[model samples]
Target: VDKDRDPVLGEFFTTESIETCADSIVRESIQNSVDARSGSRPVDVRFSVGCVTKSETGDLFLGLWEHVSVSDEEAGRLCAENGFRYVTVEDFGTTGLRGDPEDVMGDDGDEENEFYFFVRAEGKSPKTGQRGSWGIGKYTYLDVSMINTIFVLTARGGNGPVGGSGPLAIGMAVLKNHKLEGRAYMPDGYLCEVRPLTDGDDDEDAVLPFGPDSDMPEKISAAFNLQRADEPGLSVVVPYVPDELTYEELVRSVARNYGILIGWGDLEVTVVDETGDVATMDSDSILAVLGSLEDNSEREELIDELNLALWGVGLTPGDRTELGRHPLGKHPSWHTDGLMTEEQAKIIRDELAGGRSLAVRVPVPVTEKPDDVTRWSYLDVFFGSSEKKANKPHFYRQGLRISEIPSDTVSGLHALVIIDDEELAGFFGAAEGVSHVNVSSETKSFKGKYAYGANWLKFIKDAPAQILRLARSSEEDEDAGLAEEYFHIPEVEPEPEKEDEPETDPDDTGDIEDPVIPPIKRRVRPYTIAPLVGGGFSVTVNSEVPEGTVLTIDVAYDMPNGNPLKNWAPQDFRLDYMTVEVEGCNLTERSGNRITVASTGESLFKVSVRGFGSNRDLFVDVSLSEDS
Candidate 1:
């Protein structure tokens, strides 16, 4: 039984690493507390750390450990030697534990009593719309304890008879065989044993202390300050904290798990040490906490911005019709009601109605192109930044992120999917236990289908192309696959140059064959428009050339809409070089990579050549002034 239960219980947490145990504890505890909230007020949860020093308690803690410990003699000895460190989590403004005491031993209990089901019930939860849909989170309390013991005390409301007095229960969870008979024989071999009440019957010995009529052990109350007094809530004390887990780790872990809640003023979490209040996570204190941590500095600014954008200044009522345009370009957006593919739109509308669906296209800046692995690291850091490149669509149910397709799983431009509909929740495999999103069945590949439920591969596969077209670069089109497409150039008609001198008749009669007049010609433009590679304009010259006079032509690239291709270096086209060719003119000297042409004995001429450097073999045409 011990061997069978060891591995089974070990697999309860998402991570086995000791560093993340505090994170698990924080996520599970806060989730339960938030779900157990009673009134309209937000939950106030506090995570504090303290030491049980021998000098302060006078061996009371050591004696208590010796009294409760079972099967592990060395663990008990260690507790006596060093008085033990503890982590106490308290949640105020919640309904305290209330339930029948005897129901713990049986299968069914009062449904309204959250306390009995929370601690005693296994594989069942009584709360609705809770973060913890599955009951696996209840195991975290015991798993985080080094000695596998937890001390629970609750103050119920004034409804039932036990509510007026409050109740306290101790449970030590360790995997060991039940012994029928022993020197310290206990019923069912329970590690936790309750002391009998002063005025109670024999049957009430093992039940949790109840009501103002009964008194709690003075040593227990004094050691932990567990007295509820007038307040009604629950307090959990974990004895024998793991040596490796520190208070700093606890604070950061809590921040990572519930920072969204903290930033939005939904909850308040305070970390208290022996000295005083160490740190607090709230809406106003987010910047200070962000600046204090060195590792997540880049992520801090993004979190602050997102929190404000999402929760603080959210979209106003009746504003859903007006779409928000990104600064870069107008990304393509569609709804099930739109006219794009009636059949598909109807399916989407029926399945995910009342949800705002969007596919945004965000271009990658050329400055920060790290290696492939480092690109995905930002997802882990930022977690839920709006610009985070989720290759496949991410699903958000009720403004809370539930499912996301990893970048590596699907390729192409970055896209986002945030749906506010309750109907679409089950379509994305969100009903898979408490993990929310189901893991792929193939352990080796993350790109496989979901473990269970509808994967919707075809629906997500077609969305990127629709959105990617909105921010498509000027270089390529859909079918040609990265081939440059030329932008239309408005034709330039050169006005006939005003001749300075009037026409003169040939001297003495027309004996020189009427001085065969040369027709003015225009050069055919060689290069494609500059907009092909990036943002810019191209010029075409139609100036006439003078007889026997050399003309020098120069061309250069310019950026009109800032530097979009800063990452690309300018290089000469290897296949096609720029040159000047006249129909009836001599190809004269070429200097500084520019062409110099001279009319040699011919009446009419036109110059033609391949485009200049970085023009990608476009044809440029030039005509001389004399030809006009």
Candidate 2:
């Protein structure tokens, strides 16, 4: 860079420029002054323009030249096309000072110096409902001119200090010239140049009367006039206005910026031409614009009402004193004598004793804005005595019932909890067991249908005692189900059987009538049988049966009738020693035995027994088969 720096690059990087446009700076300054003086007192604003012509001498025509311009017309055309030229000067002087003035003050001291031009034109507030009590708005006029000189004249009305003592007029002149060397910029510079025509001062210091014979220009003099008697306000006269600034465009620009004429009843604005023809505007148009700016303002009001209704119940302990009663007068008494049958009083007492259950309903009004479709719009709470005392209550009971009504059937609606135990404690001191709350809505159905009905009971159950203890515990133990647990029973397995001893040698030969049958060992073993009273006998079967093998048994019951029987069905049967079954058993025996059965292969056989009149018995004899 040091070896081959370009002059163009150096100039581009080093250039400095003003941050804001000249017109914006001027408008902002004037707005600041108007805002300062707009509170509690109205201010009148006036504007004037004059064209300056060069004389033979090199001396600049400082009077009219102060407001004239020779710059390019591009900025002016842009400002006019965008409706900037239609601004209302008076409103800008009143409402445009929303920010701090110190940040707007430039090194030129334009804001402070321009204050002298901001004479309180009226002794009352402007038509616009704006609060600006400082006279800082006059600086905007500087945007239209480069001239160092400005002339200001202000006349006070009967409402001012000199009321009915004749109008008090104050005149001031200000000057700024870039070519004038050695002149330091003055922050609060205002010089009195024009005196009352009747002052009889020297002609150089006195302003000539505004007439055809006067040396004063027609344009400058024509702008000065007293507001009509019916007008009942002040007037300002600005001399040496820039020729380039059109009075119509300047008035319109002022209207656009500050014309939200709120709270101003029957206010009027008029501009008089040199021919004395007047053009007028009313404040109603501006009011309409302001109304459009804030469309949802009514909904907010409804919300406020809902909040008030929900929380407006029960007096606090401190509030009891304010109600002309002792704090403990209405306290709950365990003694039965303190309770009475008075219906209204009983309802109150029961509500307090049983704990309060607050329900809120919100309605969706049909409007341009889309309605919220989520379930969160509804709120329900169930307060228990213990939980209430602990300053905590159940919130958002899941099953709260809500019924929505169409907007045609009701007024607009929204709901909110404005106050509750926590909020009351935060705002006022705690009321040990009392919770005061408020909720409001535009809909009556939420209040009439839900709040006054039994629907709330179905949604929120009374808080259990366990929940109260949990709320009061200082420890972090929230396991409420610690005392309850469940267990499952395991299944049992059957025991294995013991093997039996063989009674005869396997090598003994014997005659066998049935060759397919195996040889059997006969043995006698003592057994105990317990006879059941009806007819069934409990028997223990001892055998060397292998595990996992199915077993079958056959038995014959001998009845008192003494008739031989072949089959009998056991009325009731169960195996105590081992599992067994009978096949093809039926009631066939009549006299001696009620049932009988024969074995085919194994010593185990299916058994059956029967008895008369529900009485039955069975016996089986085990012996080696005669055929073997």
Candidate 3:
């Protein structure tokens, strides 16, 4: 058997496998194209597909097959002239074709080289300067498609060699499924050939035969007469398509697969329908569709629901204008009234600008679960700066995170919302009295009364006054002095004695007790000094008594010593001359000799004692004569 005649061999994959494999291929091809076109020239890529139809039950090919064509020489020249030297095609399957497995594994050896069709576009490689890597991607179409025929054609500016040497243009066709003796269906079918634009003497040569005979299915011939322009580039045609595929489906599939073809300015795709009317589809339309979002109330509702859900998790809801900034941002016309006020918006912007470290806690009612509460929660408020970079505010963005806490540690569910503006500085100091109330027991509620810093002095000063008033009020209400009544002493009862008591002598063998000594009293005298004739002297008191006591003093002085020399002397030091006072007590006197003072000194005067035990006339005057 001829090597070319051998049947293609491979495990044909199902349609699902083909789609999975195709997705990755398409992505990689587009990435390569994008990378090549990164700098210098912009690359416009377009993808288009044509229809396919199946003829028999065993024929597995279905729907439309993708076709990618590029301006080969033009793209190559663009790459060489510009810095871009790479052209890539994505969406080709791992097997290199968009069709069944049998199409890819035709005759393992090089006996009959299998060929595939692909678009050739130019781009710059980010890493290296290169265009078309060894034609590896070029054969991707043949590897997957069961179609055995391939067609390629090129036009040259200056013809010099076999491969179009000058301004190089080249075109070729392959018919792998052709029969040698009878009519044969070309591997790419009859549509694989490239027809000349201008009629020439070699028209017969241009119309190449697929096999030795012409009795093959006319469906392959139906693809003939595809004209090629004499422009400076290549044109390729693949004619045979499975009956299961439609032209529209094929165009869509190709557009989805090789997205670059649509943007290729020189490359254009036209699919003729059954009526012979050609329809053109732009790849940009598909791209626009993919990038666009559906505008509807359902979408708006979905966005609102998401916002509500995230709000429960502590994210604040933003206004419609702010929400419009996100890619998925949505706003409902009906809910516009619920937007934030200008002040609230400013606060949110400031908080977000602060940084992610800050957070604020807004108090919510205990009856309203955090998940259910909306208005009172911070989650309902929008935060963050209007600018993207300096977005979050410092206070709300940084410091200690805020949280809402229950009022009582055990029972009451009151919320203590604490917004920690700073992490290091605690919200409450030690001296700051903090209290909570358990409403369960009305009177036994928790109450703390303390002062911070110097304020404690005021609390201390008022405490005694308040306590005294409370004590007095309680006593008045009860008709009794509580403290005095509670502290009253009772009389002691005498013990009963035994009848058989022995008599004891006073000094026989008894314990002796120490004798008690009485306290001794010391006497102090006061003296007045006077001058003789015309001069005067000062008086001093000499006291032998100890400090801190009251004494009664008297003094009488004459001009000469030891005698009352004159009838009378000027009474300068009278009984009522000096005033007396005691420290730490309210006792004071002006006339009497009795006085109290904390210190003892010579300034104190002597006192006179009048009252005695038996005699009413017993008197002692602590007076000093002027002469002595």
Candidate 4:
């Protein structure tokens, strides 16, 4: 089994990967459809749930009952009498799982093999984020199955008309370890077209998605009442669904997660109940569909935001306000443009102050690894303030709402961040933990994928919050006067050789002479540096740093031995973890106990660093990294 295989013990990892399997199903389905769009046409997804008699489907899962049941006798009786319920998700205007049918391994020249990745492989999705985990979204389909089985039908583009010549179908199961004919087998099982093996070695026949383009897949497709009439897309049937998961929840999931997508007119979805009742959601009906859920006990504030806040998306470049662009690898600061021109900043402040909404086009800098050639990527932020209670920030990458990561909150604030950029989305998407909620920088997807992956991740999540703060507040932090005691190097002429003084004896009553103390060297500081409330500090530059002047700041816990820098260690802390706010200069590096910044020719600049633990006193020393 593959190392990253969705474990059978986990019921296809539903417990590990998602908080709500309902949302995961919706998020995954729409994301796949969007990625596989067939040209400029908007994607349409249909979620239909209904009942099917067990006898009608025949021996599809004849032997997996024991493995599927968790006190399922009640389920068996219900199904036998009233028929088992099934969920069929169908997508339109998408090139169905396209690739060589039998390419089990990814050696098929094509960088992306949707067919192989979805049907034949585990943890090898064709649609990982720009730089993310292998396959986080694909497991939901199988996980939704209580019986650990699902049927798939697709029509690749190269094959004639969709339903006519390119249709292919198969069934997959990821179940608990079990025995077949007294022989043990892993949960990864497949139902494919069976034919005579021409290769004499019977063992060479693997559990592949396609053996032949036969009538079996089509027959199963018809039996499941799938609506894919050769329309060129993938349709999946998750049978034996738990009755507790209703079609309405799916509707709420779609609306809650993809409201922005629907508002943008890029997606359309329909949810159908067992009674054939339909709830259609598109650009016009998104709000209308959600209106029905107003009385719902599960209705959340996030869902309510769809109606509460005025939203605006920038389909055109001019619709969005451009913030400062980050020049990755060049500096920790944004492009020389600064966060925004004074006029632009004022406009943003006026909008927020007037209770108006704003959307920003933020250019996120991306790098594959530390200090590599930088590539630019873009993510958008939509924010507004209200008189209502404060709330935490909400983040979405590739159309899915990521719940974890930002724990900080601000009052009367509402913001939605969308990372539609494929590269950054993928990187961050992969960072979403097994719960598939919070974005993490410690994951393998982040560790070596980019330079300062951790820092960039925090910045993106905090961008909207920071922007809101910038617009509403204007005050420099009060500084603790510590420069006089730390940065300056005091010096004095070598103390005159002190005449030896006799030590006082136990019986003597004479007073002892004080020892001669050496004076510290007096060093010069170009600017005043003071400590902030937290472990951070601030630097006030009275004059512009020369073009070639490189400034480096070092911080360490003040040791009683006198020389604080002598025993500094990384195990104690990192500069990046401390809150750093720098303007008029780009922080080039934050490592170990030092922060290096490049001068940006600003005549007067203020730099602040905070968020350090207040328990310990830190000695912050600032100096020039290079000659001016």
> For this target, which candidate reaches the highest lDDT against the unseen true structure?
4
Q: After superposition, how far is residue 100 of candidate 1 from its true place, in Å?
A: 2.5
Q: Please, what are the lDDT tens digits per residue for candidate 3 over residues 404-499?
A: 111111000111112222211111111111110001111111113211212222222122122112222222222113222221111123444435
Tens-place lDDT per residue, model 4, 1-628, is 3333433324335434444567878877787788788878779999998888867887666655544443345433443454688889999988887776655456423544677677666654555563224554566777677665788888666545322336777788776665645777666667775443444356555444542356767667767888888677889898878766688778878887777677678889999999989999888888777667766523555554554333555346775788877654554533233676666667777776677777877778777765586778878877666443445567777666676655334445567777777777866776666445777776655677877777777678767656644553333344435444433322223435445665657897777667666555444456677654324567766677775467777778876676777688877776655455566676678778888787777775666665456677776676665544
Candidate 4 Cα errors over 4 Å, as ranges:
1-19, 63-82, 128-133, 159-165, 196-203, 208-213, 296-311, 315-319, 327-337, 434-436, 473-628
Candidate 1 local lDDT, 1-628, one digit each (tens):
0111113233445532333667767777886777667787767888877777666555334334543355456565666564677788888877766665534443333445665565555555554334554454666776677766666667766565343435554443543332323554332222244655445566655544333444443344467655355466777878677775567777776665566566656677888875665788777885567567656633453354335334322444332221222222222222222313333334323322233332222221111112312110001011122332212333333323333233211121223344333323222322333443332323211223232212233223233333322122222322211222432232456545444554767676755544544465553443223322222223222333356744433333333443322322335221112222234455564443345566654444433333233443323222334332
Query: Order of all candidates by TM-score, from best down to worst?
Result: 4, 1, 2, 3
For candidate 2, report its TM-score.
Answer: 0.26
Error of 1 at 45 (Å): 0.3
lDDT of each: 0.45, 0.27, 0.26, 0.66
**Which residue window of length 10 is worst by lDDT in model 1?**
374-383
| Order of the predicted models by lDDT, top scorer first | 4, 1, 2, 3
Comparing 1 with 2 on TM-score, the higher-scoring candidate is 1
Best by TM-score: 4
lDDT of 1 at 107: 32
